[model samples]
Target: MRIVFILVLAVGVGLAGFAVSIAKDRFDQYQTALAEQRNAILPTTQVVVVNRQVRYGETLTEDDVSLIRWPAEHVPFGAFTSIEELFPENDELRTVVRIMEQDEPVLLAKVTAPGEDAGVASRLEEGMRALALRVDVSSGVSGFLRPGDRVDIYWTGTGRSGEGVTRLIRANVQLIAVDQIADEQRNNPTIARTITVTARPEDVAALTQAQSTGSLTLALVGVGDITESETVEVSTSELLGDVEIIAEGPEVCTVRNRRGADVIITQVPCVN
Candidate 1:
């Protein structure tokens, strides 16, 4: 009985030693793997990134951005490294050129100048001209029209037929400014006395002449709407339905001449 008890104790001790040896080997392997992973990682650098969603034309402030440690190997080209690089001496011109998502690296190409305002030039494309039009409550789409909205412009006045007519003078004009503000970043409703739009140089001439001859009104297009331009006009008949607008032109004169017993009336052009 004593020999059997000793044998059992020795077996228990042997099993304990084996378990410890196995645990030590696993711990060493874990430490070696952790060291290898640390050596393989590339160095990181600090780069400016938009901490929140930013809209186009919005002025940049310190609160709108943050610095994040970015992998040096994958750091974006033209990325700003510090706040001084973005707004030097507290310049307000470093506005957004395009919509920026949260955590997006703020690249130099995505912002305007440090002291520049989001003016008319930033909103216009090449070969485009910015034209301002006087608008009332009705002509401006009841003040719902905003910057970056597309509209169809209409002119209401006398037509070449010597009759009143309302026709579409311009289609797909992009509104860049409402009142004096350009490329506004908010979605709030505003009533602007005047609005500016970007137009092709060729369309500017027609818009200028139309405003002088008649009144120009805007029709807002649906957001994300993409449609082909079609001819849109409203005559008195079209507006009232089943009504005809008669154009008065040169008057015709009737002459009655008596021959024998019959009187003949002839139509002739009226002289001044």
Candidate 2:
């Protein structure tokens, strides 16, 4: 029994030695491989890991490159150097940069078309094109004419018949985009209200004529109706003339005494 116990103790000692030897061999092999890899690539290239956090809004400039540095341990895995494992000291492996914000300047202009008057111009903005047309704003009739208001266009023309009587030519016109930029006018103290309208090279003359002869009345439409052209055409005659408006008489009256009331006011006033 004493001999058997001694034999078991010797076997245990042998096994422990063998395990230590194996571990030492593996560690040497790993160190040799790492050294070889470092010699092969470390001189020619630099591997750095970032230490800070970067955000999406941050801008990177060429001058910011000096903040990166190499990590402590170097090892080779298949293709890549196993950067994450070997470079445990690196958090971001790059530098966190902050970017500055800037504001870009812009210019806006207001333009008007012929016969297209102020009421129409006010509704216009910077990016619109004007097709000149005549509109009638007799007195203060078409609502309170202002910039940015959308209106339907109506055109009227006079046509001579064979019998020498004048026939009325009437049709609907589209009030394209308003030509003036309200924001620029309101914001800039020096800028006046102008409107932009879309027009062909040829229509400029007809628009000017329409402004002179015909009357354009604004037909206020909903926001959805203001966009896109359904159709456009030249017509003669008046649109607002078709609608009759009643005016109230003066509110206050003056009274005269007998001396002034008996005077004959008409026969003696001829000045040729």
Candidate 3:
């Protein structure tokens, strides 16, 4: 009876040991999988982002911004990784040139250079000039024109034939300011007496001439619109859809005969 009891105890102990071995193997596999998952995570870097909504012309300060861990591979171009790079010691503070929302990453394009004001000049690209055109409620897209919006300019005046004509003068012209406001976040539809646009030097000269001799109208372009406007012109007659009818004279046949050095011609009825 004692031997039987001893054998039973030995069997129970071996079964317990086998169960422990299985659990240990499963725990080791789980630990290996967890380490691999941690290694597979993308590396991150600190990026400067706005802490609150910032509008154009507003000054950007250290308090208004914070650092966040952003994916290193997906960091935006011109992003400032450190606060020191964005605000150098003894340098003038930077100003916002474009609207930036909360938590938005600060980019070089959205802010002006240090000490630079948020003006139309900051919005103009190199080799581009800003020109202001006179506009009313009617010619300014019903006062819905805003900064950073694109527009198509039209000129209406008398042509060389002394007839009224309307022609598309420019297409996809970028507006930098509406009246005195340069903020792109302005949504109020106030009638702007003048709107400013940035264009090349030659384009500015042409637009000046057109504005001087004719009325300029602004046509708002749709957001993200990349289609270019084709050459378009409408004359007074064309607008009325009037077609000119030319009077056709009766068809006549002519016969010519040469008699020595003299030639004789006779007109006769035409035969089909």
Candidate 4:
């Protein structure tokens, strides 16, 4: 009876140990699955951003920026992922072309190329030229125009028929600067005397001629407005609702008589 009792007790202990081991393995698998699910839900990436407010024409340095973890799926285009990408060379640096607030992402469009200055030339793309136009308060959209805004240019001058005409000279032209101010953050109403724009070679020529021949006015385009403008021209007569009328006279019929050598032509009434 003592021998049988010892074997049963030993078997019972062995079964309890196996059950505990299996439970421990299942708990480990549960922990690993939970970690993988958390990672998938909140994936992130490191992005370089400005630590302090940086203004236009200011040199960007290593100490002025920091890296933060941003959502991998929503990262902005042209955002720098690492410090080395923003500052490629130790000896060279880039200048800010637009104002960047604190903690803002450093974008390629807001900064100049390495060793380049913040100038109008840097803002222009290939095959584009910067052109300046003279403007006053009335013609410059009451000093509410900004650098990044699009505008429609109008020309007011005398027409070939000796009438005053106002026509749309250019549509959807982008303004790069207003009176030497290229910062898009500027909101104060400034009566600018000159505004700079980027245009193709042909447009530059046409704008230059239009500026010299007559007065030019700027019409501000709304943000995200991509509607194409039609050919718009207004004359002084049209503005006053004047219409020209033509009067018709009675029809006259002529009868030709062949006399000896000369033909005689006389007006006669039509029978029909």
Candidate 5:
């Protein structure tokens, strides 16, 4: 019985030692593989990446972003290299101009200036004035108008000669907003009651006068299309070929009295 017990004990000890050796071998292989992976990685740049999903017009903060090691050769233009670069002086007050997804690099063009909110004026170029014009379905291009669209402004009303006329007031006017919204994300078609456009200061007075004296209409132009040629003024005659027919003029006729006045009446060619 003693001999049998010793043999069983020896077998159990051997099996345990074998298991430990296998575990040690696996651990050493794992460590060696991890080291090899680290050595194979290329040098990277610490780039600021969006830590979470960010929507357009939403302000960004430090917590909303994180640093990621991007390959140095593949870094995009204007990519923020560090947290400080993304938020200068640790200021996180920046509005997003475009949507950002998690792990995406943050670029200068994607965010507004520090402490700047995403306002309509922020989208304007230098020396441009944002002018809001009232619009309806017919004038607003039937809700197909959007920010960044260009349009030709047309004024339609009676002229001094009492003839209806349509004049192209402004050409290639940039449309910046529909109603109060200026988001590019809101592209759904809607009948906007007003449209905001950017125009030069010199053209504001003309636009104001056109809106007051005549009905203003918008004709959307093709994207990226600009026509430098001058547009001609149009009237009834220009639209219809050879529309020279004169309207009937009033004629002079003598008054005719009925037979009941003095038992006699004078006819004057049935009053013409």
Candidate 6:
């Protein structure tokens, strides 16, 4: 029994040692292979585009870029071989691509405009704000307004607050543009397609209120004097004191003819 136990113990110890040795060998081999691969990748110069425009359908290639900016810094050098990876697959964007040529950056701008007029957008200079306003003509409702045209903005009233009561407190908001001049000889006088107005701070509220209260009404202002003043608050008494008011006095009923007439006649009692 003792011999058998000793033999079993020896076999167990030998097996455990063998397993540890195998594991150590595999670990060393893996570390050596990983170091060699890392060294090999570090020495090669990847041909990458330094700075160029990335456009749609542009394939990524190793020759597109020279010196990888930084794998984890400027751009992920290892993941993307070309500029196409920077943009979404279906995105319509123009990206600037860069590539190193003799250790120098060369830039490029790619275009992704689809059937869009480049001239119209390019002509719009800096510091100029663009606003889109709806315009209508006699032909029908039209929004095909070009960059240049004169128009008047008007609001319409629904007249819902009884016939006697005023439906609109204030109606008719004029043109919205401030820097507008009309050459009537060049354009039509009676009709306007869309009225774009340049308005001051005070006028902006008036126009905004018009949009809420009533339908906008467009009235053309020619080369005449355009004067606008700040509104002053005044009571009804102050506004209408000078105006004539014809009001009936208090009712005093008196008997008229024998035929019984319901007439509103006034008379003074006779003193004997």
Candidate with the larger lDDT of 2 and 5: 5
Pairs that clash in candidate 5: none
Higher lDDT: candidate 3 or 4? Answer: 4
Query: lDDT, candidate 2, residue 230?
Result: 51
lDDT of 2 by residue, 1-272 (tens): 99999999999999999999999999999999999998876332233222333232232222322222233243222112234422234332221112112211100111122222334343434554356443333411232333344445444444343221222222223333222333211222222222233444454555556546644444555646635545544322233235566999745544444565584333333344
lDDT of 1 by residue, 1-272 (tens): 99999999999999999999999999999999999999998899999999899877788898999999999989899899898888787555488866789999998767777776566786677789999999988998888888889999999998887778899888888888898765456577787899999988889899999999999988999888899679888876567778657999877799999999999999988888
Q: After superposition, how far is residue 118 of candidate 4 from its true place, in Å?
A: 1.4
Tens digit of lDDT per residue, candidate 3, span 1-272? 99999999999999999999999999999999999999999999999999999988889999999999999999999899999878889678999988889999999999988888887788878899999999998999898999989999999999999999999999999998998999888899999999999999999999999999999998999998999899999999999887879999988799999999999999988899
Worst 10 residues of 4 by lDDT: 83-92
TM-score quality measure for candidate 2: 0.26
- Poorest 10 consecutive residues of model 5 by lDDT? 263-272
Clashing pairs in 1: 93-116
- Candidate 6 residue lDDT tens string, 148-231: 333345445444442211122222233323223221122334334444444445556665675676454333334353544233
**Predicted candidate 4 versus true structure: per-residue lDDT over 20-132, tens digit per residue:** 99999999999999998987886789999999999988999999999999999999999999999989865689999988999999999889988999889999989999999
lDDT of 6 at 99: 18
* Winning model by lDDT: 4
After superposing candidate 3 on the true structure, give the runs of residues whose Cα lies further than 4 Å from its correct spot: 1-22, 244-272
Instruction: Judging by TM-score, tell me the better candidate of 2 and 3.
Output: 3
> What 10-residue stretch in candidate 6 is worst by lDDT?
163-172
TM-score, each model?
A: 0.59, 0.26, 0.80, 0.72, 0.64, 0.25
The collision pairs in model 4 are: none
Q: After superposing candidate 2, which stretches have Cα over 4 Å from the reference?
A: 1-143, 162-181, 184-198, 226-272
Clashes of each: 1, 25, 0, 0, 0, 38
Scored against the true structure, residue 216 in model 5 reaches a CA lDDT of 92
Best by TM-score: 3
How many backbone overlaps does candidate 5 show? Answer: 0
